[model samples]
Target: MCSHYDPVLNAQKLKQHFGVDDLPPGLKPSLWPTYVGPFLRKHEHADVGDEAVPFKELMVGSFGLIPHWAKDTKIARQTYNARSETVHEKPAFRDSWRLNRHCIIPAEAIFEPDWRSGKGVATRIVRTDGKPMGIAGIWTGWKNPANGEILRSFSMLTVNADDHSFMRNFHKPDDEKRMVVILHEDEYDGWLNSTAEDARHYLRQYPADGMRVAVHD
Candidate 1:
């Protein structure tokens, strides 16, 4: 599961690569659980049949999902990544999953720990083509009752990666290996608009050959 990553911070790259027209303020260069970052979701006006409005809209949200019933935002630390197989059953993620609140996390790279060397070594993973990765996710809004402040948050969707030649190398030897779902460029719109049933088709693992990993110093 991804807990640390580099978000696409360049305005030009956000626009050219993700088709996001504007960059919202307060996005960080690096993100961890509870950190605010950029994500893409279907524009609200898209269903209105307006051809002039873009299909996707850029949003800034917490990296970890905060359920509506939560008392505070601290729960975000434990809800950063939702397992694809159990997302529908998990209380924190089920509502968003059922509602088809799909989102795309725009990331420059994801950081994981490599344990092959007998010690945890930080590694940076990115696409071989040097393009941004559009990771699959689900989003929702949580309101703080005390102040009535609305906070938007999301969680990355992960799949088992024990059989993946590349992804299986990360994490601990005894732990179940996992990897985030990286969607292909062409599937962005399909994923954003897909129904709960169709969203499963986009949760598969990304091909290992298309990715490059290096030791992070």
Candidate 2:
């Protein structure tokens, strides 16, 4: 599960990357499950057109997913990641997927536990080209019944990485290997708008050769 990442870009950079006109002010430089960060979702009322695709303004949402049917926020910690094979069938994520509530979580770098040296060590992974990655995700809105406050949250999608040359080096030796679904820049729009059948094509491991990793003390 990817629980942390470097959200190093500011609102201006995010707006430019997603081609949006507005974003929330004062975004943080890093984010964890409970932190608020920017995500791009399709506009709710975009009209059918051939000239241009309508994009919704950038939205600030929490990283952990809190399904609308969830009774409380405690479930979010366990819902941070949804496996690709089950995302369409899981109770917590199926509704969002069915409704086409998809999103993109941009990250400058992501942290993982690298066990290559025979001991678990923290490692930061980033693109070899030094550009941010658009991780595929799903989002939904939840309301606190007590205060009637609505909160939107998301979960990163992951796929099996037991055979991945690079990603297989992380996590515990005995644990099941997994990696987040990092989408190519060109697939951003398609991921946010593609039907479930077509979206399956986007859920695969990014090439290991395109990434670099640094072990931390």
- In lDDT terms, which candidate is top? 1
Tens digit per residue, CA lDDT, model 2, 38-118: 777887665466446575546778888899988878777788899999999999999998887888887888889888798
Cα error, candidate 1, residue 179 (Å): 0.2
- Candidate 2 wrongly placed segments (more than 4 Å): 48-53, 214-217
What is the alpha-carbon lDDT for the whole of candidate 1?
0.93
Off by over 4 Å in 1: 215-217
Q: In candidate 2, how many clashes are counted?
A: 0
Q: Please name the candidate that would achieve the greatest TM-score relative to the true structure.
A: 1
CA lDDT of 146 in candidate 1?
92
Candidate 1 collision pairs? none
* TM-score, structure 2 vs. true: 0.91
